[model samples]
Target: MILREQLITQGVSEKLLDDVEKFKAFYALTDQNLTSRVPQTETVFYGKDIWAMCISALLEEENILLSGPKATGKNVLADNICELFGRPQWNTSFHVNTDSASLIGTDTFIDNEVKLRRGSVYECAIHGGFGVFDEINMAKNDALVVLHSALDYRKIIDVPGYEKIGLHEATRFIGTMNYEYAGTKELNEALVSRFMTIDIPQIKEETLMVILKNNFADANEEMLSQFAGVFLDLQAKSRNSEISTKSVDLRGIIGSLKTIRRGLKPMLAVDMGVIGKSFDQYEKEIVLDVIRTRIRESWEAEDIFPER
Candidate 1:
């Protein structure tokens, strides 16, 4: 099913969809130039309740802050939300060095004349696009002070040498952060208050199996279950502080399946995708042990799936 149909079936209120359509129609009547920034994503976000909550927040014009641990589908849901609303997306990955000039814009000399180079936030604000502030807590609080006005009721971007620009009515900002990640700072209360925060939970075993089946259609149910089990086992280890999260990657599991499909040995493919992610020898050994416990070294494509 298409994204919109999936959303409606997944419990997003009909009114919310109507509101989004109305918002789009209103923008169509205006002369504002809006560039298409929608992302082409293959991942689907499950859980009807979470979909409803996100739709409710956007319809109310509230900025959303998604906080969770790594690989909990945070970025996936952000991209999915943009698709569901049919709005242009401007993804700005925040880091320690991301400054106000990067969020807003900077004056640059071009063609013998000084012109303002609009940044992600600036363009999103004016064009009614969704701005994704990825890993927001990675940046220092002082650097993010400029966002206070834009996020708050003021909804205005104050450029030092330029006129203030009001954000479009349809403009919304979504901030994502992995709270447990190293080097991430606690978001100050002032900045936190401006957004409606949601704590994204880890993907459930059933959901993980669904995702794995969707991606690895050629794999049998038992093998898919084993892959999901391995991921959950690694997740449990990380949660218990037995190892760092560097080795627990959902994407890596899918990557391994793809490599195996290409006729590579299953163990070697899993090693390249899952174990190879960690640079530390100790970490690699730990990850390899998990794989060993899950799949035997003698296992081949026939062991995981029916021969096509």
Candidate 2:
């Protein structure tokens, strides 16, 4: 209680301060109390501090952008942020058809009268919660226009027929995207100017191995290293345009390693990890070749396989 008051004294707005109070109370009473649950200590995530800083900035009502390739732990990073901050999160995935009504609020005809139903952004803002806008670049420019007002100095949303609502001080939006990919437009200067962008690097081999060990305690360490190496190799191929971006999946590797530990054959595990990622026959073959070559090399180094 005193801390909340102190936050208000430190220039946090009244609405946000009050919302935080409500959040604290809810946690104390609700069966699913978020505050009581401890954050994960066993799963090691490298560059985790960058996400913490981003969350801190959000607590101060600053906007942020996270740019990274697929399976770089972007969503996990977001989840950890909410867990650490003790805030509820609302997720809004952007696509070509996303519009103002989708972000700001929409009035629906009910009982012959239109009533405003808050969108994810609106609900998160008013409730002093965090919002994650996933794949923000996938949205059309017109769809993002509503955010300019919400994010900028105005810090308010005005629905013509309804009340003008100011943002709660703790309300923050985290936008995630993979900027290097095709079909993603450069974030317009106006929108780009509003955010503090953090470039998330691809997960390193050591970090990936740590994740595997934590997730699969029974797996051979050498085999886990091979799995990580395969993903890194695929990532390099993607970067070089030798293969499409979808070829690499760190999550898939972990899942397949778990399968391998459960007595699945190496080829079967590799298929589980690499084959399903592709929809095209050609892409699948390429991924399979890469996986076989890498895993074979790793196995031979341990004298477990005979070289051709």
Best by TM-score: 1
Candidate 1: Cα lDDT at 215: 77
Query: Which residue pairs in model 1 clash with each other?
Result: none
Candidate 1, lDDT over the whole model: 0.85
- State the RMSD for candidate 2: 7.8
Name the regions of candidate 2 deviating beyond 4 angstroms: 1-44, 180-182, 239-241, 279-286, 296-308
Compared to the true structure, candidate 2 yields what TM-score?
0.77
TM-score of each: 0.90, 0.77
Candidate 1 structure quality by residue, lDDT tens digits, 210-243: 7888777888888878888778888888889887
lDDT of 2: 0.70
Error of 1 at 138 (Å): 1.7
Please list all clashing residue pairs in model 2, or write none if there are none: none
